[model samples]
Target: SAVISQKPSRDICQRGTSLTIQCQVDSQVTMMFWYRQQPGQSLTLIATANQGSEATYESGFVIDKFPISRPNLTFSTLTVSNLSPEDSSIYLCSVAGSLSYEQYFGPGTRLTVT
Candidate 1:
């Protein structure tokens, strides 16, 4: 199992602001995933960031809006661009287990755009 941590457990930002969320893993991992969970909604994959390569964003997500960076095997970052009230959601950082497909998530950074 891998332990991941994220910054800013929660934040309230004004519209049009951007927030950069950090993710750190206790151990090296083969893959790291970023997800967004809207209020009362399921997790949505934003991108997959693996070491030695560029992050891959999902169909609906573009790199310009949600730039991602993976500096090493145990660290990654996700930045939300052009924030809006609709962007308010719980951003979670996750990594899958070595032998299991199950993923472990960070406590999450809850963002509220006001």
Candidate 2:
């Protein structure tokens, strides 16, 4: 199992500002993903960051809005650009484990845009 941790567990920002959330795993993992959980809503995948390749974003999400970087196997970052009040949500970092169905998630970064 991989242990994941996110930085700036909670933050409050002004509208139009951007925040870069960091995800760090204790071990090298190949499949890392970013997700957003709006208040009272289920998780929505933002993108998948694979080492040495460009991050693949999910529908309704664009690379320009949520740019992701996977510089190596154990580290990744997601930057939310041009934030708005609607962008306030809990951002999570997930990783697929050795088993096909196993997945682990970080604590999550909670952002509030005003």
Residues 1-114, model 2: lDDT tens digits: 899999989999999999999999999999999999999999999999999999998989999999999999999999999999999999999999999578899999999999
Off by over 4 Å in 2: none
Highest TM-score scorer: 2
- lDDT tens digits, residues 7-99, model 1? 988999999889999999999887899999999999999999988899999999999889999999899999999999999999999998886
Per-residue error (Å), model 1, residue 81: 0.6
Cα deviation of 49, candidate 1, in Å = 0.6
- Per-candidate TM-scores read 0.96, 0.98
**Model 2 lDDT-worst window of ten:** 96-105
